[model samples]
Target: MNASTAWRVPSPAEIPGLSYDALVEHLRLSKVNVGHYQSVVSALQEELAKRSPTNAYRCTKCGHTEYQVGAIRTARSGWSSFFGVETAQYHAIICAHCKYTEFYQGKVPPGQQALDFLFGS
Candidate 1:
């Protein structure tokens, strides 16, 4: 892969599909710069942390106490949709045993959220 294609940060959807070893190999093969490689690795690590099971949550379906936290963003209203603004953020709690997911609405500062959405950071 060329630097142009390889240097882009992985999206949330893509992070789940990439293993750390595979990501490192790909970055090495593509000869990505150290800074970019570190950024990608950090993003992947954050995703991995989010998916790791924790004892804080209990699953309503199977009574499992272990769960993982994920997140989602959406355009909630007509204007937001028309402008392609992700006005709604959600916390997704997933059961480790049965994979049952529940979403709870979350609030983030509008300016920071917009910047994150625009930059994919």
Candidate 2:
């Protein structure tokens, strides 16, 4: 995928002005709606903690708890389905030792809670 389509960590300049209102507006217009990108990171940190070695979460394939959340992404369901189109969000967690990746549903705050509720959180 091209850089435009691929996900990457945003630069500091990419963030809106440093202000509460700017932060609010950022969340309001975000593709992954949480109060801020930092909020999303915070959530991810919490979730990853559950999978940390201290929590006894181990990679099913390699028996390791060392993993990294590569990115937050969304998936779409069939548009022609009887129930209509649907989308779900997830965190891509990969085992550092074995590079085994797993997609956990509802692992992130999601762009919106309603979206997760509708998509099976």
Q: Cα RMSDs of all predictions?
A: 11.9, 13.4
In terms of lDDT, model 1 sits at 0.67
Clashes of 2: 1
Per-candidate TM-scores read 0.47, 0.35
Candidate 1 local lDDT, 20-39, one digit each (tens): 54455544543555665564
Q: Scored by CA lDDT, what does every candidate get?
A: 0.67, 0.51
> On residues 1-121, what C-alpha lDDT tens digit does candidate 2 reach at each position?
2456234433355433223333333444444744446534443344445444436657989898787875553446544133332355555778889988887554334355445456743
Q: In model 2, which residue pairs have backbone atoms overlapping below 3 Å?
A: 33-111
Best by TM-score: 1
Alpha carbon deviation, residue 70, candidate 2 (Å): 2.4
